[model samples]
Target: MVNDPHALHHRLVDRPRLTGLAFAPDGTRLVASVQTLDDEGTRYVPELWEVDPAGERDARLVTGSRRGDFAPAFAADGTLLFLSDRDPQDPPGPALWALPGNGEADRIAHHPGGLTAFAAASRASTLAWTAALMPGAKDPDTHAALLHERDRARVTAVLYEATPTRADGMDLGPAEPHTFVLRGDAPPVDAGAQGLAGAGDMALSPDGSLVAYTRAPTSTAPDTNVVVIADASTGEERRTFSRPGHQYYVPAFTADGTRLICQRLREETYDSEWQVTLVALDPESGEETDLLPDFDNWPWPGRVLPSPVPGDTTLWFTGDERGHRPVFRRDPDGTVTRLTASGAYTSLCVTPDGTGLYALRSALDSPPRAVRLDAGKPDQEPVLLRAPGDLGPLPGTLTEVRTTGDDGFGLRAWLVVPEDTGPGNPAPLLVEAHGGPQGSWSDWPWQWNPWPFVARGYAVLLPDPALSSGYGQRMQERGRGQYGGRPYRDVIALTDAALARDDLDAGRTALAGWSYGGYLANCAATRTDRFRALVSHAGLWNLEAFEGETDMHTYFREIFGDPRTRRERYEADSPHLDAENLMTPMLIVHSGKDYRVPTSQSMALHHDLRRQGVPAKFLYFPEEGHGIDAPNHLRLVYETALNFLDHHVRGEEWRRPGLL
Candidate 1:
């Protein structure tokens, strides 16, 4: 399992992804959602599994189907409710299904476009969900009829008066997302969303009296969001949280329903970067309490959960700090403590007794798994519970590299080297850039997992340059409006730090990245010629064009300013403007459906490279989006990208796939 690249590649692309942790009302049952490659090996199949909460035994499968079952939750009666597209032939998006102790799972309710988000109250029988509905449609029956009319009329184009027309890979304003609440056995009632904005990211109070949710496209920009709390049964607004230019969202009610714990982020200005903070707000008085008033790291508000113990206002969440996302516990007295020793965590849930937590953690050498974290024990490793199958050990050893940038800024990177690599046998190196430019490479990402490359004897460097998260806001502010300046230099500095080691071969090196990282890869190719090969997946090339057409124009404007109005940065940083200087062989990967960076960037770069007679290859996925998430396509990606690197950096003959 350690030395075989073929077997590693299979597991890397096909392993089950576990997420969505939830404990039943009585804490007797702990369950999660696991997605694995279906029987046909073509699509993913989601299944509900009840794992031992005590962290002692293997998980037990609760239910499954061909169309898929996901997002497991529990009502107060100990009944399990999940989202499933059980009728595959009908193909209506996931409908709500409930599995009781003595009966089979049955469809409880469904909407026109199926369920998007679902939630169950901790101590009550209230269930709230969100789904798409045609404009002005009040209920599921009305929405279904309207949908049928649209299909009967062959409607394809959407009419939007003010909202955005597109976002990343999604076409906005087709069917509006609406919230619905089911209190008793009657029916789900429409919980009127704030104005015309869509509803999602909701939380129910412990007593199930109030449902708090966030509305998207906040009637202004994508950055601004409003959290609104409404009556669970009547669907009437009770409270709304918002500010002039800042965003307050991801509302989680405390166990006693006295305080609402969520996150707040002041919109970025020209001189400062966005800093996210965890905050607690009084539901009735509207007073605010900064949970992490002086805390530096940005805690993810979506993972916030409150302990159910009486009078305990302690909240648990996770955040990226340095190269890991560790679970954090915030005590009632304002003391914030980290619980897990290492690894990235999500799907956080508090134990019924409020003494511990269950979360999913992932690292470079392992995939996501259920783990137990005891409060106030940051030194102890998370206790892992046995999952379904045997995922053998990976082939590499985790290590770190660090250096000081030319500007005196500290730069860090995660290094994964083959177990056999040492002074006697130095291995080739592949430097991969982290995306976001604003996000850090803190976890094991299945799409860009490095173990397969390590299994093939190539050391992988995951560098967090300027503009990355987890670091203080200043580190990210250093690269704002200057995408090509500090980040590129920081990458080179970190690469030099890695190359200085005895276990790595400096001469055999390759560069790769997607999105912002891809932009940096292009910057490296333009400014330096130290690497043998480079790969850019759905990366930006023309900065002005990308900011003008990308779905996240709102985000780009905050960082680089308006390309039309502020053309200086775009002209200086656009990769296409400097493509003539690229010397190393490059692989350009893009999906036809990728609207985030757009396929046009890759096409234009490929055209430029071919015209200049530069050695390059283009891998395209027509049916996939920005992620290229299809199983077979992912297999091809690993085969093709690694083969390209092996041929150029490892000095191996090109082993192209016979199918291509």
Candidate 2:
């Protein structure tokens, strides 16, 4: 049997995954990087595309092909700077490149190693990108190998600029690497230190005196703090007040350079507690003012919301508190106004002058599209910048159902039924779980996700079980430290209710999830014989092993209780302990380089399943991290999962044989 799910010639497929959006310096235009999933599954030819804020025409593709190009930003002089993986020298990783605003493009320079983050310098033609250059090759299988090599990989942030007379090109001449020391490691040299572990966002004050970025320890917890102001010249820093319980992210500076705005995390919940409040920070005095109402939480590092009104205390940011992050305007005095009320926005960026806001919006039914919101006239409707030809229309008649699980907990979920519903026609059911036992499944759009399940004649059920964010504080706390217990019961009960409906095919039921969802899939397999098949991407099977193997171990006690003190409790709840009960056939996929849920968890599950003579197959991805990073990997994952489900659920003979 064929292992690839896309093997079926007429099957509907979602080949392109869109993410990483940015706006031109002037804000009149925007660019985004999109991942395409074709019949081949996953391939990364991150195409850079341009869109006008006014949805006058479709977005135009800027970069072409799988050689890879993404993360585009226009310089003050109108030169576009973006990251490309076309470096034959680097073997499929990111490198800095430049293009004339008119579309002429050429490579600038290769990164020192893995180019993790890149931001163009404000006012100047200079650009900066983060790199991690390892000392030597180490096996990715062992934790010691990863730790040793990761430690050996000296990280440094470097600034690069095209030489003079190169407005149309990147002059790789003047490249300078900035260095720093670990807290107690050295004499604090500014060159050779890991400044920000996960520094994906960066902002420069208009005056160019101060730079703001998010700093989170890569090997530690996901918590972050905002580093507000740093002398761009000397690297000396001043921080905003320590948000005691919050991890500050995406600290942005206003044009005047006096006030800084940032996104701060307030509380940890599976859902809505994370917010994007417009905070005002005095760069010099380190004082802060909350200029926006405490609204539903948003992801850290505020999205460059609608452009900031020059000299006005009002700024724009996105938060899901009111639902899925509709763009909101926050005035200095703390009045919040909604800008776009229709679909959920994933990314937002404002122009420097504050006259216009460029945003990307996608619904559970569609792929992301670019739009321009004019703050100058609030009543003006958003202009659709670009909509791809491939983006299919959303499903018809979606329903949000509220049902009580057997545990008596009120479970909220979305039910996407086929339009052809009729008597004696039961649709197959696919239960999709969200990761981040701390993460929630929202009413957000699903392009490469849920929509695909629905498109394939499967009734998709996405439940916001206890620990989801939208409801409030209490609901989110219900699942903490209760993994594989009440939460799993809530899901099982939900499934039972769905199965009771005559329109759902109970005999053809399947379960799928990523990250924490991965853990839950394992939980469902061992917990009950309800599902006919299971698909776990970047999933975890062993908790005791994960506690010490993951980067988030610092908070293990907070989420799963202390493993040492509660060994029996941890073991009792772990999927590894229940492996013998995992009667449903399962397929496991993981990235070799994933640090969050390291590959070993999958390895552990595979080894145990093999020893027990269970039906299972494990696919390992090379050159990828916790998530699917390339088209090839994504293709392999999707195809394997779909085929696996087809085999067990539909009684299709398994084509690709499993190791077991």
Candidate 3:
């Protein structure tokens, strides 16, 4: 029942993680991937667990293995299919495995480069998955031979003639991913290469006659993906659905198979805020209709979960609203119904009859848990089906704070007050900024959980500023070209509003952020020294360096313009230029492998702060990425961050974290 940071961390890391959920054809059984730490606690092993959706029986372990198994899909014939890294153990690569509802799992199909993603058609009993294909290899056999030869010869060098030679959390590729199809007991068929950027958001037709996938036209412009519908049997392109400046993905065919419904992002400019809309396309006529024409909220809310509700024209999706992610259902007539009142939902799945909806719900005080939604009664509380992780009681109470920024825009923030905080004993405030500069702090963040800080008797403020999504398009435009302008002001304005409350202590405040939040933290340090302490994790300090080194160079150039040509935006918004004004004692955390906001940004900031005699400490994780994922590394991150705040904000003696 412990609620402290260390205890919470231990509980979180050791708990069985549930994800990748799928329901059987009869809707009687639901399958989910359960991930648990290995005996040594170095890594995670995934197993498939079957549970009765009716909650009549206890969850049963369907598949037990030390190897990682995930991406569960049920075939039309009641066969359970999943991707596993089981046998031929030396070099582990995912292969398709099947369970016949009452027998041992059997390998159904294998790939040379390992499966990345897969989708199965319930009616057609067909399977499609994406796998990497080696350069110059025409078939899987050739690809496998090339891999074997490379392993034998110890050939590790990768020659990239593409725009992105390196990617975060992946090896530099000599092999490009392509989709493949597998029919019952038949030779696997190549559905064709999805350009150099690989395939994503693959959806198969109910009859298994057509395969719809999204891929970039060129390797240089990976962000500009277009949906392509092709024949599953012959691998022949039938139709290409795309607009000149828009990106389309997540194509799902209607149950009747007349139209393809998916998400479309209007490509205005690299720097401009793109509007995501639900669009339905008549596969025959090529006419596209904006389903939710007036819906301004971003449809793809939270992590990239399953958005489309199968077997009906009605689609269930999530959108951000006033610091909450709520579920919304769009009828075939284009009428949108707001389902859940509050809280964030993801990994959405609807029952076969379309009457019942299921998803994982979470909030500021709760971790993700499986819940069944009453589609008819939109306001009803979701029935909690299961929660694998043991998220003990909250150490604080959660509330919202609202204020209008200097620009007349309404700003909203979530305030977490420690249980001990009140009028008699106000708690120190920690104003935490969210990343995405374009993203909102709405969902339950498992990786960057705020419970640790709340457990430490500090009140945490999470604000949605100008550039945050789910607020209308106008809100996004507020901080578009200017990074430090309205967004920074909105954060400060919200913080001030929160501090006005009797329960929050304003005098002992601190600012902390990661990624874009990190960028804002840097911006805050330069703009004002009101806060006693500041922490920036993988934050962007130099605009010029970030544009050049970031993976999305074209996107950055579109927003800020080229540093060489659009010099004004960079000079005006960059936090590094105002380094001389920084007076707050800072803690800079960065990972060597953070390609998006390269480690160089942190290095530059740390060096500048030290040179300017501004007290600063640098915590570097050489083996980590943009976000810390390793259990030990995550624990150390929280410990160090809390210690930094305790020293500067709470005026406690500094104690270095053991690893540091």
- Which candidate has the top score in lDDT? 1
Off by over 4 Å in 1: 1-5, 63-67, 88-91, 194-199, 218-222, 267-270, 299-302
Q: Judging by TM-score, tell me the better candidate of 2 and 3.
A: 3
lDDT of 3 by residue, 474-588 (tens): 8877777767788888999999999999988889999999998999999988989899999999999999989898876666776787788888888988999988898899999
Cα lDDT, model 3, residue 212:
80
TM-score of decoy 2: 0.78
Lowest lDDT block of 10, candidate 1: 1-10
Q: What is the lDDT of residue 248 in candidate 2?
A: 64
Query: Residue 551 of model 2: what lDDT?
Result: 60
Candidate 2 CA-lDDT value: 0.60
C-alpha lDDT of residue 581 in model 1? 93
Q: Estimate each model's TM-score.
A: 0.95, 0.78, 0.95
Residue 87's C-alpha lDDT in candidate 1?
60
Worst 10 residues of 3 by lDDT: 300-309
